[model samples]
Target: MEPDRSTPRTSSRRGFLLTGGALASTLTETSMAQAATRARNTGDADAAPGSPQHPVVTRPADWQPVAERLDGVGRLGTDGLVYRATFPRYDLDLSSYGVSGLVEASYAAFARYPDGRTMLMGDVVATETELQRVTDAVQAHGLEQCAIHKHLLAHRPALWWTHIRGVSTDPVALAVAMRAGLDATATPGPRDPDTAPPAGLDTAAIDAALGAKGVSLDGYRFSFARAETISDDDCVVPPAMGVTTSFTFRSVGHGSAAVSGDFVMTAGEVQQVVKTLRHGGIDVVELHNHALSDNPRLFYLHLWAIGPAVSLARTLRTANAATNLGVVTPDANSSMSTES
Candidate 1:
């Protein structure tokens, strides 16, 4: 063997091929075993700790009883805070609607100077009857009127929005009272299925702009964000008023969409918002304060725009940036300083 060092190894071609094949088969079997083992482990992961199916059970608290009794409409939490419910109504027929009278009364009473002080704040639609009922209700409940306006236009029956507020130790009592006023009106309940979705605008674009993930409601889609801070008589607001800003997009057909949303802003941010919307060709239908004595004060603006939903959303983003509005805490010092 030493003498023949230069000679080639003596394995046949077939033998070489057979050896290579066997090695390859061994590798393949090993790989497959590993893959199957991994699959089994993955399947077993369901029984592992912290798995979704084996979620930890939490003990119920006594407060749950009180919360259930409230029908979840309102709740008093352990933090010593009382939450209130806000109800908004839309109707196509305001004048002949039974609730029209109540709406008008509430507005009128809210507008009267003396009534304004006790009531604190309220809002109304433009229709004469609606305003009258709202004013009257404000007077009756000793609540205040804050603004009168329209949330939408060319809506089937005619639409109006009223913002009302009152302060009471017993928020539930207040809600019950408010319900009585609402019951007096023939405001239609939720829309019927037969009621077709509002026609118009590009549905897909609107969906993309809103980032709405849920199913559409009556062909209209909506997104809502909660106010960053609420105030109580110039201090940190307790969570009593269900204060939230909602953005809604309606399909207007032919790739056109209607964009409208409520923005909750502080005094300092109002001018910037107005300017931004104007620059974007959006209309600021109404800009006014919603609360009278709230600490840091809050203002609500009703905005409208007609365009592609994505474009509208971009404009909204710009407008939102102009104000100290977002999920994160705004520069507190900056926001307060700007308020001056």
Candidate 2:
């Protein structure tokens, strides 16, 4: 996969989780999760404008150690000093209809904060039945469930997607917590890496259209993230957390594709983005907020289209540029990749 330098934008398992807590009876699971988040963030009163400064606690996550903890293989991306583990749901049937490997759960970009603390962020895709239990595990482990929504329209199994976020001086502890959440579902462990099949779409044309880099999945799918570091509650939030404008291209044949995925945007950037999509003859499937109180209040738009891959990529790039990419100053120390 090659990198596309265009202007910007930018899950697993199954297990039964037993949760324990003493609390008032009025709070629902979602509210309780929000409360847990607030309690975790209570210390950030006088935060600075950009990246966070925290006391060094432990070393960053080791490759084999983290892999062993999560029952998967962790690969490091030198581009952003990020290590990620991907757990795919082979149990799902989207592939039966030729959608082909669209259901993947991944935790990416585990890195050390400047102060020596560790931060990690990821997206975990689960179904309706599995969503609550997964969120419970995340909250029980003190990890934050920042956003919850869908990526496709009217797919069977009624899937829902959620973004996971956490920070600690102890990277191992973070992995343990992440593993706890993964265990709450039927998410499987490491598997043999599949060979890349031809994606069939003109990938070079897509790169040119979006002006960003994305990876081709066995010739079935193409995905990219326009990365950005975010700040909301007076702290420098890591970009890998849930702050990317992501696009996924599914090949449908004859140089056309079925476009599905979402864009991460600030509240101020939403309307014009929708306009841009409509201008390109694309349909805005759903527009909604992903998180409750993230620093910049992220809004996501799930979009769909059917056309030449390059044509859709160019249209998506326009919509992507409407977000906070070029408008925001990235953390001075951040090595994030973005174009817009």
Candidate 3:
């Protein structure tokens, strides 16, 4: 009886191993067969009608019409983005006033995103009636009004700024609507195009320092800093806002120059950056947010200095190093059309 029991136990162990091995083999076969079936289904779907291969809608040709419409409404193209056609001021006092008010409105408008279509708008206003007129016009245009803050401390006629935005498949249509809003405000005085550089500045050396192509305008030769990290929230940022730090040099004459431009930074870096710029003899004008949900939460500080352009560029490079930013050139596929 004992011998028979031992034999049965041995047979039982062998049977369990055999069953586990067979079950494992069966499961593997089933998994492989399911994967192959899924692959075939995916291939069949790609070959089916009405896929991305046969899209349902057509895209527009060019955004030129949209640009023209924006222009018609008193919006000017600078660098690429359409800005409202308004008087330009070089003085920190006046420019600050304009930028402050304009930036406020712009931020407020942009906050309405997705559902409302209108996001941000910018304006320069004085009288209460003028403000109302601008607001009324903006609402009529289906745009969202975001902010109205001051860029400068002291200015005549009390200048103010407004920010505005809108979402639409038709860019031209958006422009036309915006134009109606601008028509309500007073036309800004003509900007002086002949502002002279200080003197004795070496523009060539400055350009070389910046290490990028330069463009001269209104007595100042400007070098665009390489595009760096952009953010939409507190995460890594993309380069959609055109939030670049430009270094502009004004020849002080005889190899000397004055430099000025904006430096984009995060809230955490503001104090350190301001100190750094001041140590380099740069004037900090305005520090503010240009967007609501930029991941890294960017802050822009408009800075100025009177020095050699090259020296200014070097100083700016030093400031650039204080942040987690790196120069980057956009790729071809990265360029997207704002078409419907």
Candidate 4:
């Protein structure tokens, strides 16, 4: 009887192994078949990201009309996912800490998804008097008013930044809605050719200090994207869609520069960045949300500082290192269109 019991126990063990193996094999086969089907359906044979499931990148010609609709020149961001146009508040004689135009700009960005829908993200700069009208106009056209906040601690003419979001199958219609909001404010038209002089700061040292190349647009500018994916409403949000940590340095003269921009931070990194920047003598202007339903919940801390160009760069570098960031690389597919 004992011998028979042991034999049964051994047979049971063998059967379990056989069933487990067969089940695993079946699962593998099913998974492989499903993957193959998906690959075929998506034409993503290599399963590369930013494939057909991601935003539909547009050519310059495709976005020219959008630019015209905004009555502004648009630039296809370096990532090729977002087309962006800026509205510098040139009409406002704004000044903050002896600097004008330090943070006096608004922008509209359009991203096209594979589903043939377009999303708009913009920050419309308005005066205290114009804010209500701007909000009314944006809501009148069915755009979502995501956030309202300030980018400076104290400034003349009292400006407000309104973050806007909208989705439409008709992108030109979306632009018209955005244009309606802009019309409610005194924000100027398309940018003029940048006739400003070269930033009189030490460029090489600034680059080395920040570990990123600077572009001479409006000011000596540096843009850094986060290392991780950020999304809104389950769709990936590109960095150029007003999510990048931006720093603009304008020479205040005698090797010193006035620096102002925002740091895009996660919840946990906010205090650290603030402490680091304050410890470096940078004034933390405002802390606020830029979107309604962004995953990981981003907080933007607008900052201001005036110091030696390299010293300020080093301070910003330290603050930047307080968060997760990816290295910048120039891509060949990137092109900026100035169509208006």
Q: Using TM-score as the measure, which candidate wins?
A: 4
Ranking by lDDT: 4, 2, 3, 1
Q: Tens digit of lDDT per residue, candidate 4, span 1-340? A: 0001111221111100011111111112345654453344335235464333345444455676677888756777543467787777778777887787653677777776554556788878889999999999987787778788888778898988888877665677677777888999987777563535445788788899988877666667777778987766635677777777887777888888888888888999999999999888899888988887776689888988999889888989998999987754222012111100
Residue 39 in model 1: lDDT: 48
- 63 in model 2: Cα distance from truth in Å? 4.7
Greater-lDDT candidate between 2 and 3: 2
Q: lDDT values of the candidates?
A: 0.40, 0.55, 0.41, 0.68
lDDT tens digits, residue span 79-153, model 3: 122223332332323233222211111111111111111112333343334677877876766655444554434
Backbone-clash count (model 3): 58
* Poorest 10 consecutive residues by lDDT, candidate 3: 10-19
Off by over 4 Å in 1: 1-127, 153-159, 190-215, 218-228, 238-242, 328-340
Clashes per candidate (backbone, < 3 Å) = 45, 29, 58, 0
TM-score of each: 0.54, 0.70, 0.54, 0.80
- Regions more than 4 Å wrong, model 4: 1-53, 101-103, 193-199, 329-340
**Candidate 2's TM-score:** 0.70
Model 4 lDDT, full chain set: 0.68
Estimate the lDDT of model 1: 0.40
Cα-based lDDT at residue 156, candidate 1:
38
Of candidates 2 and 1, the better by lDDT? 2
